[model samples]
Target: MADVKSKASVLLVGGGSVGAIAALNLETGKQAAVTIVCRSNFNAVSQNGYNIKSCDHGKINNWKPTKVLNAIPKASEGSTFDYIVCVTKNVPDVPPSLSDLIRPAVVPGKTVIVLIQNGLNIEKPLIAAYPQNIVLSGVSLIGANEPSPGHIDQDFPDTLFIGAFANPNLSPQTQKAAAEDFVSRYSAGGKTQCSLDTRVDWTRWRKLVYNSCLNSICAITDLDTGRIRLADDAVAHLVRPAMLEIVAAAKAAGHELPATVVDDMIEMDPLDMYLPPSMLSDTRKGNFIEYENILGEPLREGEKLGVPMPTLRVLYYLCQAIQWKNKELRGLVSIPPKGNYVT
Candidate 1:
């Protein structure tokens, strides 16, 4: 084992499914001392620890990290974190942005901000917030979730692709080193897959092909990926066309995706598998969905480049309406009384 004193101090800011499983692997690496900031799960995790059944790490019971905190400020107190891994959802339209939430713990040049969330253009806000800091763009392809507080289940193996977001303020060497360092620590245990990609935007756009098309479809229709494919003419008429639009947009944005990527993504899951996507899960729970990053941003980008995305445009508005309805249902938004007819 590496010397305890030499372990990098990591403050993980999300304790959801992805966050919880990530904490497990980070702790397992032995290269970082992970302190997970649990918001909703704080009580359960702090009191009972986590019970995880994983295909990657095997079944581990009552697993707790080196440290756990209820809030981000508490983790920041008297501690200078070397890395702040943000595994939270990137709901840009929501209040208390991720940059704002994690600002207190950021040590500027020292603390590397690693974002493991979804959607497009996620790095821009962080880059603007901490211009001097090295921001690593991470794309996680793992299937993990906490069904309940302190209870985790991961059927898919972890495959993480990490790369540094270009910052004019910091040298490429500095950014590259930070990305490499974090990838090394994350993969030190040899139980997970992490790779450094110089063209991470390519990967992001690649993921967009799936998230923008299928994830959105799943959310709006309340169908798992498999059922969506099983639906009458859904793949040929809706799913494939939407994915193709994303590919066209990605190409316009200068990241040419493989021609076969759309089909590969479609065939990734069996037709009968009842796997509800993250967006669908959020919709079921009456939580906000990430329409802005996943759809709005990409749609706007496509529009800017004169790439017509009718299917994606329709999906974006539908998802936005879902978000509005969810907010209204939760009483977070109150609609005004119907206006007097002026006609």
Candidate 2:
């Protein structure tokens, strides 16, 4: 048995639906003291705690971690965290880069950085920024969202797979041990399923087949997953082809997924599910969707690998327009006069 007396200090950034559930579990086992950064709902969470309606854990009322704050504390606070887990969206094109957001808590070689996010090659930037630190990558499949502040609705249970990102500065053995330790601590709650994955990149590629297709398509059409599936030939004409393109690109990049993966992803949801993906929810809320992370990165990879991704290219162009509109609405970007681009 592991030493239960030795408790690790964990700082979890992003207290949205996914982050809340992760924080809940991280503290449930008493293995780690968790401090969550809730940027949007700090007051609500601090006052009343999170109200989670989970299928796995049942109705969890007024669940609070060890600490909750609106922002990360500065380094001058004199507290170095053992693990900094970031469940925030990876929108590199957006302002407030991930590195800058988590820089305050990083303790050189001691603090491990863990990212549970979507998209391909999301670990590269962190690995570059923290060369001497161990970086862990997590991929999760859970249906969860915050319909209102401090309230989480989770229809699917949390099942997270974590692995160490490849880093030249740290030995593979060291990175793997750190990842395994996190998996153990994260699963201590016994409600969630957390496991260590050796082939994490391949796992990500497998997920991309679904994320690159349905996630983008649902957001573009403004339709829920069920309605998209019920549309006329939407699965055959749009979804499957796009998934095939992603699978081909993954193969070119040295990850060979199964041929039936497309079909499997398509059938995963029921026709009446009516669940909106994270990207679609962002679109509905007028927030900037992760177009660059989810689509642009994969499209660029496909181009570099010489893989033909025509369907994905179309989706990428459409998502770019949507993201641009979102930025314009929020005044985060400006458009020049119509005549400014005269040929």
Clashing residue pair totals per candidate (backbone < 3 A): 0, 0
TM agreement with the true structure for every prediction: 0.95, 0.96
lDDT of 2 by residue, 1-343 (tens): 4446478899999999999999988887678999999978889999999999998788988889999988887655886788999999888887788988898888778889998998887878887877799999899988899999999998888989999989889899999999989998988878899999999988888888888899999999998889999899988999989999999899999999987899888876666888888899999998888878788888999889999999999999999899888878888888876775657
Once superposed on the true structure, which residue ranges of model 2 sit more than 4 Å away at CA?
Answer: 3-5, 336-343
Tens digits of lDDT, candidate 1, 103-208:
8888776789999989888889998999999999999899887889899999888999999989889999999988888888888888999889899889999998
**All-Cα superposition RMSD per candidate:** 2.6, 2.6
Question: In candidate 1, where is summed lDDT lowest over 10 consecutive residues?
Answer: 1-10
Which residue pairs show collisions in model 2?
none
